[model samples]
Target chain A: MYASRTTQFIVGLFALLGIAALAILSFRLGKISILPTPGYVIYANFDNISGLKPGDEVDIAGVRIGKVLGASLSDNQARVAMEIDKGVQIDNDAIASILSMGIIGGKYVSIQLGGGDKTLSNGDIIRQTQSAFVLENAIGQFINNIGQSGGSKDSSSSQDSQQSQQKK
Target chain B: MQVVEFIERVGAYILDSILALGNFALFLIRSLMYAVLPPYKLRLTLRQIRIIGAESLMLIVLISTFTGMVLGLQGYHTLHLFGAEDSLGTLVGLALVRELGPVLAALMIAARAGSAMAAELGSMQASEQIDALTVMAINPVQYLVSPRMIAGVVSFPILTVIFNVIGIWAGYAVGCGLLGASGGAYFNNLAANMSRHDVALTLYKALVFGVVVMSVCCYKGYHAKRMATGVSRATTEAVVLSSVLVLAWDYFMGSILL
Candidate 1:
């Protein structure tokens, strides 16, 4: 029952349209690359990665240069493997820090370019790295300090009252 | 005696359902075997694609756009409560690409093309056309069922991709255009949060839903009783069963994939 040429043409058109839509979803929206971008791998060790994930961005001074490939435990620290684009050269003494995108956003690795003359090559480990800031840890430390100071003040006030009573 | 009769009736009902399930499994396996075998009916498959895929395109586009727009509106209001309106894009994108796009598109196609498949095949069975094909030394399953199955498997993912793309853009139009959320944050969060895994999930769900829809609809119609009332009943059963199967399979896949 497939007699009409018009139907055949429309079918072909529809197939092409579907393929085009798939291409857009895969490449544009999904950001999937068939061929991995030409890049070199480097390693950085952090004490805590916080909420940083493997697919998070690796940036140099607010400019995204690559992506985090994966993270694993190495020598009691989080060893993160990052794929940096070939053109961008990271200095040997550069500092890598985990920075959040916003108040309630994802974490990314940011590199502060170092003044060292030698540049890091593939497989080089960045020695200077900063771990992600844990908000809970900071709050806990603050509360502990407050508690200690309050207890010490109360003890000193009691000691002063006892001395006055003894003198009287 | 009355209690024994009731127990016997329940046992018979359970056995009847088990037999029906076995029949469905065998029918699906036979159709799949025909689909993969050589001497592929490319012309008939194309015709089925034109009917199932091309005809449903406009309906998919319209439904997806509205769905996206609604997601954007709802997401903005909800996230705005936490002062996270900028995440509207991420919410819309993830919701559509991961879940709504495939499921909703499958349901729509099930309602539109799936019902048509059932009614057409049911009527054909009632009219003795299927018998005539069998008598003419042609395998009715291969000639009729395989092509439609192939069409469904091909069409579902394509329609889902179209749904996701259009839906996300429509969400952007509502969230950024109407709600005045920062366009950059919306898109940036989407890009940052979404991954290849999410996109793959969308396509996978579409593929499974496609198979479920085609098998259920075709099975019901193929075994339809030889009567006018039987054809109508088969059509109704096919639509309801396929839609329900699509949803049920979606839940299973989601849990497994996650």
Candidate 2:
């Protein structure tokens, strides 16, 4: 069956509009990286990773660079596998910190780029990591310090001095 | 004697189902093979794209708008309970982009364009047009099936993207415009929480749904019995089966992609 010329014109015009919408979505909403480079995976070990899940953003200097590929437990520590974008080179000594978007926002991993000349490659692990802060633990520690100081001021002072000496 | 008859009937039914499934798989393979081969039939494909994608655009947009409004209204109440009303935009955006947009778009296409394809092909088969093409040394499957399948595959994702954009706008209109929710917070949270991965997943789901719609509807139409009633029945069955298949495929794709 042959369609009228006007009908065909309408169809062609609408089809082009639909395709244009697809292009707009892929560019603006999808943010599809046009680059064909393959992402490299790396791992970090943390003592605590509360509230963080797979697909959480991994950033460096507040700029997103990757995502959490997966999270697992190994030898009583939380191990997170990250898929970093290609061309983003992380130094071997870089630090990974569990951070939150805000006080009530979701958690993510923030990387502090290191000054070392050694760059981390695929499958390399970042050794220096900071765990998520748990409010209950801090409260408990605060209560313990208060009780200890109240019970024996002199003993608490001596303990603080000893701890400072150890740090030195 | 009765028990033996019942067993025989059951066996026949099972065998028929298996045969039908085998034919469907073969049809899908043939369509894919022919789609990539030479003699592309670009004009026919474009016409089918217009019929399938362009004709279904209004329906897709209308349904998406209502769905988005409902999501925003419901999400507003739910999030308000947790003092998270600012997240209404994020909730609606993610929900549409990641799930509802693609699924609804596919379902709409299957209902409108897919049924039309089935009916047209069915009538062609009933009236001997398919036979005439075959008699002329034309490969009916390549000319008829491949073009429609390729068009469906290419168009569904485009329709879905349009559906999602309209849906998100509708949600914003309802959430911030109708309700007293803060407009800035709604849009800001949406921008922050929505991700590229979600959009990509929507497109992937739409593509699979498109393939499912075309293959299923085309199979039903191609194999329809040579009668007017048969053509009608095939049209109904094509619409119903393609709708169900799109949903099932959506579930499977969601599981895999997630």
Each candidate structure's TM-score, on Cα atoms with residue i matched to residue i, is 0.89, 0.73
TM-score of chain B of each: 0.98, 0.97
Residues B36-133 of candidate 2 have per-residue lDDT tens digits of: 99888777887887788877888988998999899889988877776677778778888988889988898899889888889889988999999999
lDDT (tens digit, per residue) of candidate 1 on B1-258: 999999999999999999999999988888889999987988888888889888999999999999999999999888887677767878999999988999999999988998888888888999999999999999999999998899999999989999999999999999999988888767767776788888889998998888889988998888889976988888889989988888888888889887
In terms of lDDT, the poorest run of 10 residues in model 1 chain B is: B184-193
Top lDDT hit = 1
* CAPRI level of candidate 2: incorrect
Native contacts present in each candidate (fraction): 0.51, 0.27
- Global lDDT scores for all candidate models: 0.86, 0.82
Per-residue accuracy of model 1 over A16-72 as CA lDDT, tens digit each:
888898788777766667796788999988878989987788889777688888999
Q: Which stretches of candidate 2 lie over 4 Å from their true place?
A: A1-12, A23-27, A30-49, A52-168
Q: Candidate 2: how many backbone clashes?
A: 0
TM-score of 2: 0.73
